[model samples]
Each structure stands twice: as C-alpha cells, then as structure tokens.
Target: MKNLSSNVTERTERRKGEEEQENTEERERLENNRFEDQDETTERARCEWDFHLRTVVSSATAASDALGVIEFGPSGELLATGGIARKIRIYRFSSLVAAASDADGGGGDVALLDHASAYDYYICTPAKLSSLRWRPGAGGRIIGSGDYDGVVTEYDLERRTPVFERDEHGGRRVWSVDYSHWEGCSVMAASGSDDGTMQMWDPRCDGGECVATVRPSATKTSSVCCVEFNPFGGPLVAVGCADRKAYGYDVRKLSDPVLILDGHQKTVTYVRFLDDRTMVSSGTDGCLKLWNIDDARAVRTYKGHVNNRSFVGLSVWRKGGLLGCGSENNQVFVYDKRWGEPIWVRGFEPTGESGCERGFVSSVCWRQVGEEDECTLVAGGSDGALQVFVGTRKPS
Candidate 1:
C-alpha cells in the first residue's frame, strides 16, 4: 500500500509540472505579441514624420503681404487664408492637390496655384485678419474672423456676405475669436482682444450684446492675444495674454480662472486645447508649453523654434500626438508630443527663390481628418506664401 501511494504522488507532481509549463509558454507568447505591437506603433510614427512639400503657392497679394491665419474647412474640401491684405481667399483643396501632383514629375517644379484660376472667391474684410475659425456644425457655410480693427465678423460663405458683426473692443485690435457649445448652451462666440478682456457673445441674443466677460490679467493693459474653447465640448475656455500667462476658465464661472499656466517670459500668443484635460500655449519667449488643466501645471516644454518676437503660429494634431509651430528662421518645425526636439523642419522658400523674404512662417494648420495612411499640412508664411505638405506611409 505504501508503494502505491508513492506512485500516485509522483503522477500528481507530473501533472502540476505540465500545467506550470503551459502557463509559462502562454505568458511568453503574450509578451512577444506586446513587443510586436510596440514595434509596429514606433514604425508608423516614423513614417508619419516623412513629410514632403507637395506644392508652394504665393497668395495673390503683393510681396509685402503677410498671411496671418489659415484654416481648413471641416470637410477638408475648402481652405481659407487671410492676412494683412485684408481679404480672405477661399480655395478648393482638390484643385490645389491636383495641381501639385501634376507638377510632381516635372523636375520637381513648384506649381503656383495662382489667384486667377485657383481660388473660388475672396471676401474683403474691414481690416487685416488676425484670426479665422470655421464655425462648427455650420455645414461649412459659416466662417468667422477677428481683425485688426477690433471687430469680429461672421460671414456666410454661400452668400459671400457678412451675417453678423460685432465691434466691442473699444477700437483695440481683436486678436482672436473662437466658438463653444454645450448641452445647456447655444453656440457662443468668444473674442480676445488688446483691450484686456475676453468677451463672450451669443448671436441669438437681440442686438448682439455681450453675454459674459472675463478679465484674466490683473493689469488693465494686458492684451489677450488668443482664445480657444475646449474642442471636446464643455464650458472650458483658455486664453493667452500679454501678461506672460495663460488662463483656463469654465464659462460658467466668469469671475475666477480654474487654471493659471504661468511660465512664459514674454507675451503668450496662442492657446489651444489638446484634449479635455490638457492644453498647449505658445509665447513670444520662444517656447510652447503643454499644461494639465486639472493640476494647473506644465507637463512639457517644446523648444527649438525661434519665436522670440512675433506670433509664429501654434497648432496641435491630437490624433498623431504632434505639435506644429512656425519659427522665426522662416521654417516650419514639427514636434512629437513625447519629445522636446523637432521631428521635422521645412523652410518656406520655394525652389530657385532668393529666400530673402523678410517674414517668418506666420501660421500652420493640419487637415482635421483623413488620417488613414496619410495626412495634409498647410502652412502660411508671413510673405503670403502658402505651402502644402503631404505625409504618407513609407513602404516597408
């Protein structure tokens, strides 16, 4: 009976060993799969950075004109560009891309999408445009612009006429305008201006009266350069100002800021939301900062772009975790959100050009959609030069 008991114990030990071996092999397979996935993600990010200049087109304005703002329509079908020329030129995206593709094989000649045949129409503004945003849910028919004359105007693109106009900044330049909507609120417009206040307006209100106003800076002379509503939908709005600070506020509470991002040594020129809880701000001190609105702290600082003086432009592509900004050195610098160094840089000068343009790249915008294997980037130079870059996956 003792011998029989020992044999049974040995059999049980063998079964236990087999189970352990199976579990170990399964873990190894899963670990291998995890590594493969990480590798694939790394490779895809590398390919996304391989940007090529697809086309370069100078705006119809004279050589002295500076293109201040560029915005792409929601559907990516239309592009609106405006600047010191006091005109907003609208172009068909397909026409620009097709023209560039046609010139691709012709000795890499840069095709100039001229004003005569390229743009659909140009909207003349009362003053030079400082900012432009396409109103969301407007079916690409409505657009808005903030101008140097301290006015914010919304236009109906279908009718080529102004639909709404407001001039409440007391003749100070209106630097930025943005829109926000929430569950309980109708569409509200916010404008940041040199008058040191951010004002919210509801177009539905009679006489277009200001609904609310928030003064972020303690000093009365502090100019609010940029304003952006949280794109993810909320009462949150961010403002960048000449006080060398940025503020995040819930529209519901206008008296106090929920977050104060203070680090820039110079004027904060732009602010944009990266997500519901995070945002980015640019300053004339030559850096872009990523902030956690919940914690009111900067998580990252992006450098390598020379932006010590003017508004060199700041934009973020959330899908790919990329940040794009213009440099004072007349180049476009793109950075991955995870890294401080630039991943790609492209100069604004076209082929065979003197490269003597006096201004830097003033604005940049990425096509919001079409991220399956490729994407498009539109950059506007202070010299009124518009360049389109296409990023495609590299063949394995």
Candidate 2:
C-alpha cells in the first residue's frame, strides 16, 4: 500500500511539471508571434518609402505641351492635365486600383482578375484649357474647365461632352475655377485678364452673370494670376496677382481685398488656401510663403526651388502634412509641413532636350485615392509631360 501511494504521488508531480512546461511553451509562442507582427509592420513602412522613391524613377511623361496645370479627380482615379497645347488630357488610376486588388488577394496574381482598368485618354480643346477642376461631390465623373478665352464649361464623364457652357467675362481669360464642396454644381469661378481685372462668376444661376469684380487699390496695379476659394466656409476668395501681392476678398462685399498679403518681390503666380485661417502663395521670388488669414501676416517661408521668376506650381496635402512644389529649374520638391523642409527632391534627367523644360514648371497637385490616407503628388512642366510622386510616411 505504501509503494502504491508513493507511485501515485510521483505521477502527480510529473503531470504538474509537464503542465507548467506546456504553459511556458505557449507563452513563448505568443511572444514570438507578437515580435513577428511588429517586425512586419516596420518592414512594410520601409517598403512603402522605398516604393515611393522608386515609382518616379524615370520621370513620368504624359502631356506633350508646355503643361500649365494638373488636377486629380475626387477618387484619384483620374488626372486632368492642361497646358499651352490648348487641350486637357485625362489619365486613369489603374495602377492604384490594381495594387489594392492585388493586396486583397494575398499580394498575389489571383487579384489580377479584379485589377482596376485603365481609361482611354480624353481630350478637350479649342477653348484652350487653362485650368481644370473636378466638381465636388460628383465622385469625379464631372469636370469643369476654364479657358484662356474666358469660358467655363462643365463636362460629364458619361456623355464626354460639355453639359453646361457659359461665357460671361467678355473674353477675359478665366484663370481659375472652383466648385463648392457641398454642392457639386454650385461653382464660383474667377477670371484675370490682360485688362487687369478680376471677375467672379456663379454658374448655378440661369443667366451666369458676373457675381463680383475686384480691382486694384489706388497704390497697386497688378494682373490677377490665380484665384481660389477658401476651404473653410462662406464665399471668401483668395487672389494672387502679377503685381506680387495676394488679396483675400469676401465675395459678398467686393469693396476691396479684405487683406493684402505682400511678400513676393515679383509676380505672385499662385495662391491656395490651406485651411480656414491659413493660405499659401508662390511667386517669381522663388519663395513659398504661408500666411495667416486673420491677421494677414506671413508666418513661414519655404525657399528651395530655383528660377521662381517664371511660373511655378504649388499643392498642399492638408491632412498628410505635405507640400509639393515644382519650379522652373526642372525639379520637384516634396516637403513635410512639420519640418518646413523638403524630404525628397526629384526631377528628370536631361535626355536629348526631352527633359522638363529648364524654365517652366506649370502645375502640381496631390492625388487622393479611395478612402486611404495615402496620396500621390503629380507635377506638369514645359516639356509637355506629367510627373507623379507617390508619398509614404516613415515607419515608427
């Protein structure tokens, strides 16, 4: 009886030891898995940066005219390019859609079946597409284009034709057009002409008439280069002019620019509202300045590009905290707003005079895709080509 009792005790001890060993192994396995997951996340972020660096390797070439401006559709699935060629070209977003589909299928060929399709090029010309914009809330199926001839045309994707056409500026070149965010068809457009006048139009009315006209103050004489609507609220307009000043106007009362932002020594080429209270402007001075709308003061200055005396394009990614600038020097600078410095610089290699023009960088914009926060930067230049830069955040 004593030996049997001892044997039972030994068995119990052995069982407990085995159970403890099993628990330890399980814990180790879980720890290993957690480490692997962390490693994967880090590697993924590095890969994304690498991909962004490589995607623009050859300097994308699309348009064949001195490109004036580039705009991305709401879904980032389409790109609208305009330039001296008097035409607007649309490029599809097949690359992103295909990549997403592949990622969903375990990053394998199985997802190719669901890959996004490419779009055929659509061209609009004769009116001289000076500026292009995608209608808000339309999912990128509608586009509004302003012409050097002071005409505004709204085109539908399905019909591939202008649904609405109006010319109210009396042949003054329409420099910029913006659609309201809440109402797709509600548009507030501005035109700057050789006559040195700035006029606003609201196309939603039956007889599209000039909503307001802005003129220079007694001390200033400048041609309006560009005009943009404030992203915040209300009917505020920001206008940049050849006289090297940016003016903010409340369309309701066009007595004068509410604020006169003067910093550029040369012509101010472009001005875009970053948010409700902040705006950015670029000029021939080769400097990009950030302004405070409330006080009408310059807060920050970003100067890295060369040959700003000519034309340059500026685009800001409000949420991603990025700014893309293209200059006449044939270079594109991508800056992190937080650091106030460029994180990456890219340009085309000179190839038998086929590279970006030495003194012309026309337009730039950040292309937003689907629901993802990722965006790609695109620029247009005098070489009549479009260049795209994909952006990614560094891993933590």
Candidate 3:
C-alpha cells in the first residue's frame, strides 16, 4: 500500500528529529564558561540612580551592528571600541575632556567626546568582531575579543602583542565573550557561539585552551546569544538562547540546569544579573523581564525598547530600581522596574551632529561609579556612533 508506506515514512522522520534534539541537549549540557554570573542573584538593593545622555562620537559613516561595541577600562580612565573594522581604538578619558574644549566641533561643555588620536591597532581576525571585554586587573592593559569567524583573541596593550587565541566552536561565529576572577581562582574567560556551545578558557593554560564546554539550551540546535558568570562567587552561569529560554547552570554539574526560565515569545537576546538574586532578560518579542531567581519566577516585566534578534545590553541602575537598554528604533531606553513601561526613550535624527546618529542602538553599559565621578551610561549601534549619558541625581 503506497499510502501506508508514506505515512510510516513521515512518522519515522518526526521521530528522528525528536531524537536528534535530545542528543543535542545531552552533548551541550555537559559544557560550560567565566562570563560573570548571568544567573539571578540574591542581594540587597543599592541607592537610587539617575541617568541622562551627554556625549556622542563616531569615526565612520556607514552603519554596522558589529561596530556598535564600546567598553571602558576597569579604572574608567580609558575607552576602547571596534567591531565592523579589523582595528580597535583606545582613547584616554582626559583626551576626551580636551576635545570638549575644542572650539569648532568640540560640542560645548559636554557635547561629543573625540579622542580618536589616542590609539589604534589591527586585529588578525579575518572577520569583524562580535564582542569585546577588557580584562580586570591592576592596570587593565589586556583586552579579549570574539570575532565573526569563531576565534577568540586576547591582546595585551602593555606589550602591544596578541597574547593568546583559540577556536573551540567548530568554526562557528562567536557571539559573546566575558572574563571573571574569583577570590582564590585562576582567571577564566567564557565565549558563547553560534555552534550551540559556550566554552571556558583559562589564560594561564598552554595556548589558552578551552577548559570546559556547556550547553544551556533545551535543544542542541539553539544558539547561545549571551553568557555571563555570577559575580556572587559561584559556579553558576546565566545563558540566553535562540530557543527563547534563559537557563541557569552550575559549571560543576552541567548534566542538569539548576533552573530554566521560559516565557519570551522569540529569541532571548540578552541576559544579565541585576544583583545576586535578580536577573534581567530581553527578547526580540519586545519585552524585558526581571526574574526573582530565588523562586525561579518573573517578578516584573517592562516594555518599550524593541529587539528583533539583536544582542542588546542591559544594566541595573545603582540607585533603587532603574534598568537600561538599547533599542531597535535607534534610541536608548531606560525603565524603572517598578513600572510597566519605560520611563523615557531618547534618540535624534541622523543629521550628523555630534551624538545624533539615529541608527539602531545596540550595545550599552553602565560605567562603574567609583571610577567615574558621575553616573555614566554609554551605548553604541548601527551608525557606528558611541553615545554617552550622564546622570543628574541630587545628593540624598
């Protein structure tokens, strides 16, 4: 019977797919990375925070999500940027101050900060970078970067040389990378890739080899969009997945996830710990949620910033309950977790003014306060522009 044979064949194909998904989960589960804890943390709240846009700068004209990367030195004295191009640029904070004084394009007291004359160097990667992070140490002279080619390279600015490199993702592009240091542990780095694995690397090891691998997804076919280590001093990591699930895993035991949070309507683009007990996650579905990790449940959901499978960054405000993220509509959005909607979202037309490049805002970070005299917020996106924001909080 031809009809009977066709039905049986269809059933066999469906079963095969299910089996493959299960095997993928099994293989990826036994892997792990040193990205700061991405898991929901359990900690006390800090003081209230206030933030506002301040400066903007750019080197190229065209838009590139790859170029929308920006990072501050550990001490906040220097800033580094590069992604779409093969070269990375470093600038001194004071140099930006000097630019603020320039008459022609110097943007008044605090308009656009341009210190492009500071430093520039080429990276050996064949493709553009996807992520960049500065190593934490006394001088913060070393930086780690992941590229579209699935390679991870560490550069030593003090030595002006490539310190180490490796590719453990089967030639898949790396999406995110981060470094971490425990009180009595060797420094380690974590990189998430399109290959559906997040691998950990030890710098002191020969050739900076991968120490462990983890699969924080329900199925092996899902890609890891973001990975972070818990700064609360644990073996746990929070991972965002293309499958629309965010998982919590302990490196010590990758065979099983400690917790799984699923509710996003699309790919989970970013996941970061708000504190030791709470985590913030964003999805292409256009919803940002804060989860109380203790119970593995959603505490609140904030909306406004749009994401269509983009790696948007999220950071907690120091004072009380503020959260910030970049938007697909070329804006920087900040919300109070206490509210259901964003407090405000701001951007300008791409008129080529100092910080007015109205391209999709993609990457964002909150500058550490002790290192920065003021509460500082920074973001980068499609237009290859770095926009900076300063907080205006009156003293308590």
lDDT of each: 0.85, 0.68, 0.72
The residue-level lDDT of candidate 2 at 124 comes to 60
* Candidate 3: stretches off by over 4 Å: 1-52, 60-66, 101-110, 113-115, 118-125, 184-186, 318-321, 351-358, 371-373, 394-396
**lDDT, candidate 1, at 103:** 80
Please provide TM-scores, in order, for all candidate models, with all chains considered together.
Answer: 0.85, 0.74, 0.78
Q: Each model's number of backbone clashes?
A: 0, 2, 22
Instruction: Give the candidate number with the greatest TM-score.
Output: 1
What's the CA RMSD of model 1 in angstroms? Answer: 6.9
Q: Local error of candidate 2 at 15, Å?
A: 81
lDDT of 2 by residue, 1-396 (tens): 999999999999999999999999999999999999878855542222321421221124343466678888776667777777766667665663454455454432211211013224566666677778887666778787878887778888777887777677678777777764423224666666534667766766654577777775343345677877776665677888887788887776789678899888888878877777889888888778889999999988887777446666788887765677886777787765544445677774442245434545567887644323466777766676455555554454
Give the Cα error of residue 333 in candidate 3, in Å: 0.4
Ranking by lDDT: 1, 3, 2
Order the candidate numbers by TM-score, best to worst: 1, 3, 2
TM-score of 1: 0.85
Worst ten-residue run, lDDT, model 1?
Answer: 350-359
Instruction: Find the candidate with the highest lDDT and give its number.
Output: 1
